[model samples]
Target: MSADEKGDFISNNHQVQPIQNSLLPIQHNPNDALPSSSNPRRNPRNMQGLLKFLLETTKNEDGTHDSEFSPMDEERKEFLMNVFESMSVNIAEKLTESLKVISQAVNITQQDDPSDCENALEVLTDLVDEVDVANDFMKIGGLQACKPCLYSPHNGIRWRAAQLVGECAQNNPLFQHNAVQLTFLDDLIKLVDTDTDERVRVKALYAISTIMRGNEKAINFFHDIDACHTLMRALQSDSDRLKIKVAFLLSTAFSGDQFLKIQLQKMGFITLLVQLIMEALEGKKITSLEHLLGALISLSKDLPDALEDCRQPNLNFLNILDNIIQTYKDDSACLETVSYASSIKQMVYSYTDVINADR
Candidate 1:
């Protein structure tokens, strides 16, 4: 056909009517000739080709692509969603197997060349983050599927695994209760204090934080195992990122009880925290300063007495508060410090009223 004729056929003069008619169920004539394979009852290859074309057109190198009217993509997404919706033992077992395969791939890649190890770790990390995969894995045994990866030679894999474990430990109480092995906590503590990889250390700190918050028994175990000191040592690390995470974890611990806050205060954590906050403010690292401000707020709420004690004859608490209020008067973060100062002022006023009343 000529180009113009082809265009006309495609646009308006096509034989779509015949095709639609053929798609309708046919009533076979009893006395007619039998159908031949040339015109087979149904052509599987055509259907397969159509499906392949739809899939390829709607997918990119990275993954599935968004489409406006792609039925195949929609069906595939729905199928995967349904598979994830069914939470059963069988599904958990299958996810465990998938994680094992990814773990093996990570190890093999790390051994072949350290350079490619990061790609493998990224793949493993993505796999662990799959909601069905993570949910099922946690159901089967939290951290069990990922436990082997913790010892992988590549720190990236170990770090990602620690983060996944932390997420699981935080959200699933059963996993938290069942998975409290001394070796696990000790390994996490070691990573927090001594891991050469900064990301690994951060992940380890988060995992420790999750464990601390998951169960009261875990908290007691951490203190009994002397993990708190390890966490404290992390605060002294040169990395500000590490310091921030350490501060956050310690803050959570403080919010749990007065005794924990007092314990941290006794360990001289407040001094380090105040210094960190001051340094962040002076350096004009606004994000770090904001985090430090939050930590300070928590400390102030939990250990007001300890903050009060920081006020010496030469360095008064009220004077420091006044300085901070003036320095950050326009900043939204300064509001936290302002609120704290206002609370302190109200308390003092109340005490003075009581004293006057007694007089």
Candidate 2:
């Protein structure tokens, strides 16, 4: 009876234990704290966890601490460094290749809902933040692919196209050199001067400013076209964004090209700016006062002949300048505006023509 009972109980217990084990939830291994296996996100700068894992694997128990870490451990460290660096280079290349593929996929023809084109442009817009990626994008005919999109009936496509151009051109001399060519520059100016969509106008102006800012060849390109006239059209556009962007470009984008500055002056930019500043002073809606003030200061410095335009009593430029300083002297948010306004007044005061002028 004892043998039969014991044998039957043992066999049944084994079977029941197997089923229970299968039904139980698996335990989590704390050692699996690494980021991922399918898409690893290891930080090269902060790889203490990986180093610790490698340390554990490479440790020699031959003499504990004495032989725990040897020359082989240093070699392993160098190998790990090389692996991470190679991985970084590979990731960058793959990312650039993905951008290239996506850029070529943006079809320029009319799409009922060009959201695919828009989404792809958005991806290109973000990825071009890296200089090498941007250079790679420009090298892979990304701009040529994007050119027709600038004329897409869809506003999103148009604006995103211009924005991607700007992203590629921003602080990128290589892209600017490629972008400042005649066809591209003409297209950008057309958008800035005539695009019905304000978003397109703003981004086109952004692209233009980025391309034309620091490049002497770009400035010469501007002179060849009616680029100054294009900018003047921007000043008059109903788009406040265009006005602000124009003002910003005026302040910082002339690249000390005296001819362009004098061209802007002769085109009555001083009078136009005076009108804008007066409107701002009168509380008529206008762009950033700081930017407007900065543009005027830049003009006065760059175009000496502009001082007479600023002094035109018909416009009452001195009165407007005083009003600006008084209005903004105490305004914390308008420190830049006040500084620029005061600079203009100080510059005028230093002139022999206005030395006797009333405060």
Model 2 lDDT, residue 286, Cα = 28
Question: Which 10 residues in a row give candidate 2 its minimum summed lDDT?
Answer: 16-25
In order of listing, the candidates' clash counts read 0, 0
lDDT of 1 by residue, 106-158 (tens): 35545455434444344434444434444345444335546666767778677
Candidate 2 Cα RMSD (Å): 20.0
Question: Which residue ranges in model 2 land beyond 4 Å of their true spot?
Answer: 1-111, 284-287, 350-359
Predicted model with the maximum lDDT: 2
TM-score: which candidate is best?
2
TM-score of 1: 0.61
lDDT of 2 at 14: 23
